[model samples]
Target: MGTTDVVLTDTSPYGSRMVTVEYEGASSVAYLRGAGGGIHGAVWLANHGQAPSSVDLDRLGRGQAPVMPRAHTRIPEGTPPFTSAELEVLWFEEGDGAALYRNGDLLAVIPGWADLERGMPGYARDAVGESPFAWSLEEALEGLAPRIAKARSYWEWRHGDGAWRSFQQFAMSHLDTRVGPPGRYWDIGGETLPTVGITERPLDEYTVLSTVGMSCQRMPTVEQYIDRPDAYARVELAVATRHEPAEAAQLFLWLARYPWHSITWLGHGHTARWYGDAAGFPLGRSYAGVLMLDTVPGLPDMSGFAFGGDEVRWLWLIPLTDHELQIAAERGHDSLGLSLPGRIP
Candidate 1:
């Protein structure tokens, strides 16, 4: 039997007023629910099951001009305060490519291969121009629901534990895991990514906390700023410390999404000064920022890393003092190496 699932939900004004009814195999059904109640909408899909055009639901949510689908069915008289249950019942009882109604007025219609109309409300149609029709429920949800699909795919992929195994295997070749599973594995929330885990491992006398998921998706900021970014597109951050695992892991929290959050790429010899008060730093008041390195001179063999067909660069997070941060900022990160002999900590 086919299954039905709600793929996306939003509560933003007009954005929340649309709805979509999609086929579920031969016998099931699915839908998209807009947060606010509405009595008007347009239908964009047909019985042929061809994929809809891509829509940037993120942009649409900001009230940008709507991207039109190839086809649409308008509700001339609009709809009544009908429940989804009523729509489902109307769906099964009606035939394919159906235009449905209640009380002798058009409510909605499942478009068909030949049920094409270049019509939409006047205001939206004029603004978008020759775009066929106004935004439809399916198109919007299709764009916005990648996170849901990604979540489902991630759970499926997790069955093999390939990512974890790969990371652990790579890490164990250089460090030690006999200390047991990470004392803490930080999971990023609300992201479509398959759990980006910040796992803490033991490296000899020091603690090495590294990010597992940051490399799962290529960093866009990295692509925009770097040359041949694919080689550096994916990165995993590591911090070696003699301090508490919790305190050292704090560096990951700040620098984990640094490239994307700050709209830049991080690479070997890159320096990032702490943005907050000195007392709030992970290392202590003495350190003001970090210098990223591909491999620490005194650390493990953390080089030549690869995962999922992409070169995964390991950025070693080394804390720097205020004076060192200033030197790196003034002359360049490379200058710090010459200016301070024992700066690595």
Candidate 2:
């Protein structure tokens, strides 16, 4: 059996436009109302069985990117516009493997270490008649300064950082060869990071929020936790920093690769498993106990340690060891005494 859903019907100065969609098993069609409400722009969803929602149809009609259902939730089909700070943060987290696009054109696919060693020097030489390693950081910066200046205006408006300064700082910090062996290719950093790679893709707050809710409900397994740590971390950071959840989920869907982890259902008598070494302490379960005076010379009477809470659950890892637990405790001090979810303090 099949079903037809009129996802959206809109009338504008141009004409009356309605998006009628149908889904049956692995087949779907989006029929557009053309001139005089005639059928046009019929597209097929050959690989996806999910029916298009009203929001998706509306976005398509409005010439905006539509969201598609993937795995356990829906995600944006195209790249969304990203601020300079967001781009910088993403690049910092992803390193050279960050995927960048502009105006639906693939701009730069930042090469990883192996790729750099094998092909970067030749590519740079062919592009500019010299090995990228030949140029010092200053020379690279000088060459890229003009491009940086041009892109700086957009970022300055988006983030209040001085024109090109933020980009310059990021380049200097991460591209420095002196920091490690990888500094040999600092020139590559100058070439790509300064350019505005993001397009004017709209990100809706509500959509992102809904996606985040879905992601939380579809929790990853331990194997998935290990494989897509960056994706998980990015989403967690986004939620922590209050970015739209849908955007984070979209990013995760775009970037995450599999051997997905098995789902560990949370219930009574069920152990929560995660990544890292198994420590004696339970992850995400808060504990209150006095720090002995022998361990710490001076401490407040009421001061106690809590292992983990709702806010810090993402920090908990698989096979959490004692030393790692201590380090996490030290780092996660701010999360102490925070109430767990569904529990009264």
Candidate 3:
């Protein structure tokens, strides 16, 4: 939580400086480099299972930039480009590896001690690149793709087109009217990219907007944290509203990357507060948050269906006022009953 200056700083041949900063009780090396008149830095956590090797210390001593000391990966080529905001580069203790994600979907994983240690200096020597941090999102994806593919063959749950069809059949089975586009028609920034889909349907009273692609990827760490993780790890969100379908769709965009972006899970009786000013919410100022549930009295139950061999849960999004949100937090979302109480209705 806090840092103390311990090891003296060493400068790189490239003019970057590496300093040992003690975080909590662990020593992490902070790499600071001058870029475009500003100094930017990244920390390599000490808990990554290996310390800087002698070659690293020797290179730093010789005023040469060491092979990248942090754990990282290269993803396969032809993989979709991830938006800068959605990309996550993580170092994991279990794999002794680094995992890359774009909007919660795993892109690649690279082993820390072997592949990165031996391969990175080759990258530096060839003038290819030093770190994912050093490149733009597109450039990073492009550069890392082949290297990651070569190091390890990667596969994800949502690997094929067949899974989408499987989900569509399950979803349409519960709906009163099966007429609607198969996938999302609009693009909104900050939403999950290439891995999630939204479909809008017009009904007699309210328009229904549902996320189709959410269940495709399993929520990370769900198995460790939740009971019956198989049933809960895969979830999709929906909203039924009298407002324009476009307006209701904004709510999905806000939440599309939430579970993985936050490194958590969502399930029945969960609540998420609006990210910004309540007034800025698509449903308007009165609704300050959302309460997720598997059932709503007047709506069809779209849950309990299997997709990609995993049970998918469809959670209805009920917008709530600050007072209602507080009540749900204290008493539980079940106390709110099955209904939409916001002005958007």
Candidate 4:
């Protein structure tokens, strides 16, 4: 059966939301409530958090763009009303995009407005376009609701790890195992992986955390290369000085092409087998394959190594001496497939 996603209220200011969602297969924040949209600001947080929107009214008043600097986790104890003239939204439609007023006014929607359009979904709040932290640990629980809502099965619900977990706890205090997906993988390692169990997810939810790439799916701020991430455009513009973005983007693309190669399973079957093969091959054989295990104990076998494709090919074609295979076995698996480069849909 397919995994189920369950949705429930998650309310809390200082903790993770404990949403009861099902089908939390992986522990990446990619499964977290709004880790994709909230941390990344793709879907917008105005509709998620207590406050109506994330627009900086002050900036709007100044005639400057009201780019929100950061997402406010909580509604200030004493704040203005939900109604605000400065409220604006940005989103794409049919063949174009627009930055409309939150209520009904269409502010400005023009070509090349992906930045403003993204902010309409709430990604624009980072006035500066990127965050400096590896991750925005102080995320709002409410923003992640859509993620769990969409991912959980009819019988399950998912929760967040940091502030999200706390929110889930507030919603139902605790969860009913058979009723729906448990809120968080409490006490698990810092991962957002699935829980293991018939009535429960196999992996621990509590300990799981989101990575930059995974976080990128939800919020642009969560980056894999940058602990504190920046917007794609920002990084693209800053590539010369900080080439990490370009490099990371390349890695992301490479990963997309070889998804089965993800070391998410804690290094197991495919890992030992594949790496074993690669290691067995002649010294320098650039062989690659998917280590299908969730995560192998000896996963990430290519620690501190890059794909020396040309060199590996030359080494493999030359053939390994007996001592070489023996030495390779001692290291780890190294299964290589004839990686025919292709494009990802």
Candidate 5:
């Protein structure tokens, strides 16, 4: 609410293992990651449980280059190769233990998401790389063939709608033609990438992000139908978030506003802030980290990207029913989480 600095310990109170916090004026968020992780059912959101200092609004607005005094990962190496406008998915490629860079300049690299569905997140670019060097939507589609095929199989099994809603206008949106890098059908199986008939016109253009060395080429954004018709179909589920009553309420309000609604919130400084509806901002967050969905984002980060610090962003598909949503929220259950016993088995 206001600016005030406080230091709090969460080691025993929540019985958590590792914890971290980011303070913005009077607000501070914290959560556990080492043990159960942030299984709060909101993707990779932030929590200020530890301790944070309140700062003056104007001073905070000066837009300080976030100085994470003590961080876990390293920054990417080299000078940025392109502007934030040049490409889509491009950046360092190493592991969680390495650093992150933008156009080659060292940026922040927090602890890698330990819980990606099939990959542990090797060194990746800034989620959204520039254009030109980055793959065109067409090129990306080709590289993503295997991933898409795999995802389609799973989707077809669960949501066997004739229209293949699982892909859900994925290709059409590319037709918008206003978002990221242009196309070049270099390896297109059918049409030349350019003639792929894709466009980026309708997209806010600002709300797109890319993924490097991931299961796919990019992680896009948007917020819509909670999970989907059955709530059982989930393409992505936030296992948890890191926030307390106040912040959680704020987040909840944004989530339960019905469909086709929107809101405007801060972008955690990683990217610019863009206005989005509160009703079902697809990309969810927690104090542990923010799980940005390529398919949908609750509030598509202005830069069309977000980062999860302590929390690990796991990708999967689970359409949540209202009953299920409430149940998970009430029990601290993750919408698409892997049960410990199940994981072990």
Candidate 6:
């Protein structure tokens, strides 16, 4: 798309002198300068529902008004910090489970099937008549401890044998090394925090065309995904030591809609384009947000080492359209009150 640039002059509380705003199709890039001629903050606007016009630029340059086209929850300052030590559980359509990661280390993954069987000993006998079940962090950890012990023993046996050593050897070695003493291993706390519930329904009508395991063909580029007709969305869930759950939700919404540039150190590479809307269902915990993109293409499977860990993990999800989500919410499938853009729930 061709770009257009406009310069406006205005004075403001911050002593702004001139602001140059450029519009390129659905995106806008702006640079603010102070009266003293020093460059201020640079802002890039995209997927914000409306493209900024020359008149909008003129108003912004003059500081006459704000150009927010949609209502957004302001991310408060001094938000809580997100550390890698907290456990995060992601429930996808393929399987329901909790992935336990502590300080960038993969502790264990307890599948929902296993959780159900263990949580309710008579689940098999009552499988036909059992009601839906809800899993909690405490239950996840309860199942996780034995799994961790089994993993540690397996790693110790395999590593000590020295017959199956590989580049991945160090990761397992660290697992054993990190377990300092018994009864103090794997930081399972006694309290339970607020848990965020996630519900996923299949989009059987739409199929995401992308690369999969060992395919030599290049994966679809982000631009290709953007050009596709199918509606898509992204939901990001994160946990950390310190940070307000709401603040993280707001940040996730902002990142999904805005074409913000960031550096991520995980998987094989870190270059990614985050474009969409700043509206999403907030997973009520520390640093967890879900972004749902509409009418966009599906994203290719990407992997990275989050929290500077050796375990490479693939990140992928299927985003539901507003209509689909609304239907689900109306059916009372999700109690979290998941809503679409411009929706107040």
Against the true structure, whose TM-score is highest? Answer: 3
**TM-scores of all candidate predictions against the true structure:** 0.50, 0.17, 0.52, 0.20, 0.18, 0.18
Cα-based lDDT for every prediction: 0.50, 0.25, 0.52, 0.23, 0.25, 0.27
RMSD of 6: 26.2
Model 3 score (lDDT): 0.52
Error of 1 at 170 (Å): 7.6
* Candidate number that wins on lDDT, 2 or 4: 2
Per-residue alpha-carbon lDDT of model 5 for 93-202, expressed as tens digits? 11111122334443222222323343322222222221111111222344334433443353344334543332324432432332444222111112110111111111
Per-residue alpha-carbon lDDT of candidate 4 for residues 102-185, written as tens digits (9 for 90 to 100): 355322222111232243232212122332111121242244333223323211322333533433343222223212343223
Task: Tell me the TM-score of model 2.
Answer: 0.17
lDDT score for candidate 2 against the true structure? 0.25
Q: Please give, for residues 1-345, the per-residue lDDT of candidate 3 as tens digits.
A: 243444323322112122222222222233332223222333332222332322356644653333333333222111222234654544331112344554676433332222222332111111123452222233355655553543233233234557556655556554434334333455443323325657777767777788766665566456556667667777888888887788778888888756654445788888989988877888767779888888776775675566545788888888888988998999997786644543235
Model 2, residue 71: C-alpha shift (Å): 50
Q: Model 3 shows how many backbone clashes?
A: 3
Ranking by lDDT: 3, 1, 6, 2, 5, 4
lDDT (Cα, tens digit) per residue for candidate 1, span 103-123 = 443333332121123444211
Worst 10 residues of 2 by lDDT: 291-300
For candidate 3, give the lDDT of residue 104. Answer: 72
Candidate 1 local Cα displacement, residue 192, angstroms: 6.0
Displacement of residue 296 (Cα, Å) in model 3 is 0.8
In candidate 2, position 121 carries an lDDT of 19
Better of 4 and 6 by TM-score: 4
The true-structure Cα RMSD of candidate 3 reads 13.3
lDDT string, candidate 6, 129-171, tens digits:
2221222233345645554454445335433545223322332
